[model samples]
Target: MHRHKILVVDDEHLIRWSLEQNLKKQGYDVLVCGSGEDALRLVQDEAPDLILLDIQLPGMNGIDVLERVRDVDAEIIVIMVTALGVLETAVRAMRLGAYDYINKPFNLDELAIVIKKALESHDLKREVDQLRSTQPKKFSIDSIVCASDSLSRVLDMVRKIAGSDAGTVLIQGESGTGKELIAKAIHYESARCDRPFVAINCAAVPETLLESELMGHEKGAFTDARTQKKGLFEIADGGTVFLDEIGDMPLSIQAKLLRVLEDRVFRRVGGTRDISVDVRIVSATNKDLLAAIDEKSFRGDLYYRLQVIPLLLPPLRERRDDILPLAKQFIADFNREFGKSVHEISARAEMRLLNYDWPGNVRELRNVVERAIILESDEVLQLEHLPREMLSVAGTSPASQGLNLVLPADGIDIEDVERELIQQALDATHGNQSQAARKLNLGVDAFRYRMKKFKLL
Candidate 1:
């Protein structure tokens, strides 16, 4: 839980103070200096994890300082702080080994996001460097565990696609099928892992701002356009831009996105200059784009363009062979996370997990295992540890155990039910906390926390 120390190098005292306060508020240790010379001394003295150096510094310009910093310790991450229309300097700073550059007068929220991403990238880089001689890749087809032939075939396709330089890939699947996971596997397994891998959910943003989000906008493009901003496409140049839920992208923006796919260039909103990018577009969606085209909501040409290499992730129900394996893997993961000793699923629990339809797929399965691990203390996971819904959906229950807890059709808060269960266990055990905890198969600390939460102690 070491707090990341951020060094703020800005000639303007207000900017330095503002950055320091904001960074400190975000739980980051902050160091501030006005000159690049002083910044270098701080690098040697404080050994800040990251440096936000202003391009317009008073002396020993930010570019020079960045070069010297990299030369001294390439491990230290440096993000350039630029002003409006200083594209050339930012690009130069990038070439000189700056991790990223943020514009002045930036939104604190966006700046926080940038800093977080830079640090994450720095950590990944260090990990990769350390494991270069041993680990082949952090992301690979083998990372996904599945024995189902259906998934195996899909992975075979992914293997071929990852090695190829195909630009536009369309991934279609049902909800909870891990579309973004597939996207990342493609990106990190390819040559673009070192560069930025930016993703934006097309359905998450409003139609009014999707254009600016993709292509960026000039400082005064619109009423709220306070400064020039880089979009996902620009940021992901020479890397990958994952457009999640691309079927939800509006028609107007769809045409522009198609143009970028076709020509590899685009202009900023309200700007005449063409900004070229060499990013691979990997888009995914749960919607049927062809049907959207039939309804005239989506562009037919764009649909064809996006599906240059089509990938379909089959639903969990369809891949029944993968269900048990995936559940066991999730069980192992939750065991480590929850500090539980649960090692194996009971025969009845396995049957229930395999028989019940996973409407939420892998995500739902993970949640189910997490909840079970939280409530289970035994080395073996039993049927009663699962949610009651599983029995309801599977049309059976472990009746021999002689436990009766029926949830109403209208449903009740799970927390309320948990409190009632804890109280009942305590009552049955004559208020002996250890016996009550043992009766519920819950860890002593977990059982006590619930007791406190329900005001039972």
Candidate 2:
């Protein structure tokens, strides 16, 4: 890790030398300047982590240097040092973005405390900025890419219902199908956009800790509870809480969740007082809740409360039109991150992408694209960029004979061979039309027409 750099600016050489010596002893890299002009020059050449500036300076004043520093990097922490009678100037310095004001003839210990606080504040701001960069921006639903009638209809329902505040939403989809993304889009686009959005994975947490995680616990509630702590629900008051994989929640916790939903109130784990929260509930699950209810694995009442507005997301294979676009998006993303210039995919590789079954859905597609980008050497990705299974599927149709008959081989009619394979696959699957169509890598309607023409259906 690079050293934390500190810049000290004061016209008094003795003061600057003493400050530099102290900061260097504390393991920080220090830069000393006799005047504000020299300080500005150092800032422009190599930006420092923090600047300790004296208000009184020769030539350019400290305030002028601070103004230039702020223009260069608003996030840089600045501390203004002034004499005892210059409190009013210090106040003006704060309005101009000085982090804190320190009076002269001050204790070194006190000054050290202020510096620590300023550094901590700067570190926290950096962390927040990083988190914001990773998180999807608010109200931008375009990131949830899909190109199927089923998914488009689901998105339309989400948009329409997102405006309303009364109904609870239940998002159903297979794992890796981006359920959490949908939940975020709903919360960020709603009236409670400014409020907190707390998320918890029901399946990820242990059964023993689930209650305490959902509801607050009083001090000494358990052996580890040294002090009282608010749970996720209390922290998310007047906001939204996303319960991912809701089907995996224990039956006991499910009952508690149901009570919270029905009455909008919950008691802490070991506390008598009840806490009321005006929160919106958004739950998602990969399992069939109705089946779980019938099997007594889940509470029926809670299921009903969660399913007020149901949204089902289709798996990637079901939305074949989105494959190429999603792959291209991932490719561009990885190229910039990995410092590669891979620009295009070969036609053969593109065909293989469309043909293979994406069992892991969108997440799987992203991984494949990233892997291909890493392995690819040239500007275009060839068939070798894909996994062996995908390549094999592209090489031979399961419906075809055992003979190795490559396409465009020895005057063989490619169209005739394709037609025969489609018929065989349909016949082999015993007219289970969708499965046969999937096996042949052809759309259902096209497979149906071919089956009829070949008199195989």
Candidate 3:
């Protein structure tokens, strides 16, 4: 690893010498300059990671040097050195993008603390930039594995529409059906793939804060808005902003969102300036927006704008052909994750997977596969290795595949049967109550109530 370089620019010889010695001892490649002109030259020639600049210089002052340094390389970390009473100039330097400032006659320990912070921030920025550069490949279309024609057609549609100029897209799907994944595919396939892809869930954030989260807020706009914030739309300018669970958005915010869709201009909260952003809007929801509009909870105009390129993701049961393929993918993923050698799914296991009603969709399938992979030690996933509920289905006769319900000659206990089924689901999920509840198509509270009554908790 290369050592970080630090440049100390000061007209005073003692201060520059002291800083250079201390920084050199700390394994930094230290460079020194007497005047602002010499400092600018060193900034170009040395290209130091950080510059400890003195506010009082002979020819060109430190403020001028800081501005010019930014002009040369905006990313270079600069810390202003100021006298105790020269705070006003230091504040101005901060506005010019100084990382932080230190008082002259500064404690060496305090200076060290500030320097450590600035360097860490510089490292984080580089890592983020690297991740941003590789995001397209990470979210590429090939990342989504499916064997069904319904998904294939949807992928084809994604490609066709990705090249369009700023078309609004609305993706509708059942919960856990990979709606966000589809949104990412559309974004990564588009012309603005290199830019940011900001996502926010309308349902996740509180209603009171959702508008500010989308449109940004000026400093002191509200009680807790102490600092200016750039919202999702502003941050995702020239790219895509994915509004997830858009059906749950408040109607008041819907009107604001509609204004943005109609005219790409929105004023920040408590601000007069209309900020314009060229963001592609891609909204997703599991709820029926038409139903919402009929119920007076959603805006019809916004719905029309959002549905310009509507993409519907079919539920897992409808696309039974993809279940085994998705299972195999999950097995491969878990093998790497858990360091296991499980390879193939048995024919019986596949049949059970195909027949079961996936109420929670793909996400549920992934969890089930992960659970089996973690529990089973065998090389192949057999019927016995599968979940108990799945094994129950697999064991039933071919005639009973469609409907396995048969009234016993001696009337069976219905409560006992319900408890047994719930127990099997809980066992299948390794005591994960939520997954079990989803598998049974019961609400979490209802499932908990049953578990409590059965003493399964």
Candidate 4:
């Protein structure tokens, strides 16, 4: 938002000199040019926030410069400077998007006022643009970061699904497994990238209003229907409409939805006309739609129609190889967000991250990293930064959590169970003793003694 550099363009030496001195006094980085050609070059090089342009210049007058400046960057604030009695030319300058104009009688106070207001307005605009630019990085198949083969296969499926003209897509996953992110990746990777991508959660809306929400209503359809409206399908025509939590959509709406899917046309809530749309319906649900169908809550016909291209997102715990990589990616994001220099994850913290079964999936991991980055002020992320719940769960066995075991009529040896567990850990880690010890939550010496006792060396 800080208005840094400015370029002053005029044919007169005194006009340029006076304006340069004034702007410099105001703590602005000032660049001055007398001719239109030099002014253009300075604009291209300096990329100034504001330009003080005179209407009469050597080659290609101020209006010409203003027009070309717009071509290069339309956001630059321009204020025209003209001689007295040139109202017609000044009017022409305004038409070319000049912010304001100052006449011959150099009123420093008035010029200062114009520049201050213009830059303030421009600063507001730039701040809004900056906010829009920093929104969550758009999801595309190429932008997804992962290190696990399980997820790699899922992403590979997504890549093929996106390239094809598969109109109906059903993303199935556990809650917080980023079903919507996968849906966006498919839409953005496809030819519909330039069109709108709208989303609505079927569970969040009431069953009474869900139909009206998805398939607009004509006026007088209901008491609240004050006017005709365009539904998500119509609004997202030639694009995509992401129906999150489609399993919760009521059966009545499901019947209507099946018609839309089959025929590519739908009737408004109270209208007879069939409004046709060409939107890709991307639905996602964490629930077992097949089970819902068995329960008769979800329509089987709709389920089959919707699952034309079924995409399954693997849970985060199943993709443990990606844990550390995703954690680091979140760390980098939070470092920029919180202005911290946290770069390393302590060994113990890494072990904790790799051990926990994140029922909440990637969303939980992102939140944990964000919390750690906000609270940890050091260069490394450590165990102390973790939530209390995570601390209690890390490296803890199920038996330690009060899980009871029933012994058979003939009791078995506990040492044999321990030995078998140790062997499995070693095999899982491919004989890396240190990692095997970590997996068993034992010290290297303790594991070595067990190895010697069991003759596992």
Candidate 5:
């Protein structure tokens, strides 16, 4: 939908006119300038995506204009227009940052191809700039949303330590508790944010390849080591390297990692000299490292080295208060993704969400909301939009298997007791109208009438 702008800079009248006509037919906004001075002015004003610059200009040469253009916007794509005799000048222009060059008395087809490639490069550069601009916002402290005080305290700690010069950080949490997100936030918030953030899963890599992955290897280190390779630590020298699932890392690799932590130097698998790097290590794990050490699967010294600052993330079940807020955030996200009009979740649906224990934690909750958004057609999300597993009687314990409660000396009212039982059945069944009715041993229609009378519908 976006129309690209092209600037044609040439002293020859016929060439400029031909280029303008052909480019206009190709759906580009064409601007023509007779000399380098006019081209510089149009660049400052129109800011064209691509420039077709003639090598021989009257006032200032095209290469001089390009040098000035670089000072203004280095990313501007410039294609030098040269004659056959001036081919050497075109190569010199390329060295000064010209994107590509086309021969004068050029084929229309060849010129079109060069213009297309330049525009594609320009678009890719814009996309990269946009991504670079948004990276800071992605890892900012305000990006994460939570409602519980437990998570609040955790995020507060993340804020305090994110900017510190800590050597090693260990994050421990169940799967789907957002440990990787916290790790990224720490890196982006630190002084090394401008550098790279490299991550590797210690459990995902095989033991044979894991050592080579953490430490570079010489060309003849192994059968597959055909060339000298830089490991993650070397590649992320001035940045943060996230070692995910570190508890599962093999003992052989752990010894090598320990050396890097202690001496800040490591040798390639078969290399003679050591390579020293200044890197901040942030490792995460779902397993108990202390238990792994006790079992002799993990080294005790490596465990202590990695846990210089330990961060424990509580599972979603312990933070019930965050359920609705996280659900709402997911709803907004899916609305944009699915192009839906759904806005609010019904209060009864909220109660069902609160009642169910999130065994899979936040990841399960996100999937549930995504599924609900796909199935929903109404403006408000209702209980029926939820998955059958969430609404089934299997998700809740039956009344006969309920908790033991002691009654006071003044016994509860009989009608009040009946109302409380109905509420519990509804909660357990996740607000399933028919299932709750069946659990209370009543007809569906009768149950609805009773629910209306008690204002529980």
Candidate 6:
């Protein structure tokens, strides 16, 4: 119930006094200024919520004073006051961004109405500005680099779902496929952007401890439970809870999680009463929940509940076009972080990077660029700056024969040769499936399926 502060500026003392009295009667805190200089100083120091400015000031004219005040804080509402028949001046003031204009010898009732309207508009504008400030910049969306049709479709779906209040969204993808980034984008774009976005990794925590970590525990709930604690669901009451690696969530806890999702109610581990909370759930996992359900590892009911909005993120190899763009972005970010002047990549390095399969996806590329920036002293990242494995893959030529086998002298089906090379790469990489896939320029899922098809696993 804080009163709005209003400033009254006029060379005429009588007019200033009358306006102050009227504004005070309307429950506004009024500050009176006799000259434009005093008004400008007041605006700089006090920053009143609204100003009633007279155009006929002694030293600085009202328009000039308004311009200066705008420089100080453009959002502050300014209402221009002038003598009657100064319609042209009022229009000019409006053009210069005055909130409204008032005429001298005006009706007190009309002036009060104008002030009230102006105050309301100013308050609304301030609220909108505050909300805008809370939102992440549009440029942050560019951070999600993707060019594959599947990935693009997933992004569109995420945008549409962000506008709704859907209870749960489950993102399914291979490891290093940017699932968490998509979760962040959804939360940042949704209505809950102003609230907290809490994330917990189910696989990273032990089965014995995850329940307490999620639902919290009452004092003396267990050996180390000395103090009562609020759970992640309660903490994210009005926002989102990102459950990463959800496929690995323990089955015992899954039942409680299902209850929370279905009933919007949960209880502390040893507490008696149920606590209802309003929280959006966005879960992600590299493992296939269907397979886990078939194996009696994951719950089918929870899977169905969590998949209200299912988004699948494509791996890096499937979206090759984004590789270079993502690399360049990481380079720029590393440049700023490391305070280096390296601005370009050598031709060989660029070719190697584009040709090599990035098993780690964007996260791996960022790590590679950060390593190069840290190790390289030159202005350009050269081929030598790359890891040895990447360099070896880049140097592999068709004519080279290995210890395992030799190619036919005449020729072989290029596609057959490519498949053989992929298998050899997989073998050489010691069944490090992701690394082998990268070496052979194959997508992770495709490589995995091929390995199983060929009994190479």
How many clashing pairs per prediction, in order? 0, 0, 0, 0, 0, 0
For candidate 3, which ten residues in a row score worst on lDDT? 403-412
Best model number under TM-score: 4
Candidate 3 per-residue lDDT over residues 64-123, each given as its tens digit: 999999998988999999989988998999999999998878999899889988998889
Local accuracy of candidate 1 as per-residue lDDT tens digits, 220-280: 9999999999888898999999999998999899999989989999999989999999999
Tens digits of lDDT, candidate 5, 325-414: 899899999999999988887654665676666778889999999999998788888776787677654545546435323232234455
In terms of lDDT, the best-performing candidate is: 3
Query: Per-residue lDDT tens digits of candidate 6, residues 1-457?
Result: 6589999998888888888888898899999998999998998888898899999888889999888888888888899999999899889889888999988887889988988888888778778887686555541345577666777888888888787888799998888888888888888888888788899999899987888888889999999999999889989889999999999898999999999989999999998999999998999999988999999999999999999888888777667667767778888888889898788876556665655667777788888889999998888987668876775533354445232222322334554445555555754676588998887678999888877765666
The digit string of per-residue lDDT tens for model 2 on 298-412 reads 9888888899888898888777777877888888889999999988876556665766667888899899888888887788987667775555434355455343333321234
Greater-lDDT candidate between 3 and 4 = 3
Better of 2 and 4 by lDDT: 4
TM-score pick, better of 2 and 3: 2
lDDT of 6 at 389: 75
Q: Of the candidates numbered 1 and 2, which has the greater TM-score value? A: 2
Compose the digit string of candidate 4's lDDT tens values, residues 84-200: 999998998888888888898679878888888898888888788876544324576666778889889989988888888888999999988889888898888888877899999
The TM-score values for the models, in the order shown, are: 0.59, 0.62, 0.60, 0.72, 0.69, 0.62
Superposed model 6: Cα runs more than 4 Å off:
1-68, 71-135, 138-140, 394-457
The deviation in Å at residue 328 for candidate 2 is: 0.9
Candidates 1 and 3 compared: the better one by TM-score is: 3
The models' CA-based lDDT, in order, is 0.84, 0.82, 0.87, 0.85, 0.86, 0.82
lDDT of 5 at 142: 79
Clashing pairs in 3: none
Colliding residue pairs in candidate 6: none
What does each candidate score in C-alpha RMSD? 16.3, 9.7, 14.6, 8.9, 7.8, 13.7
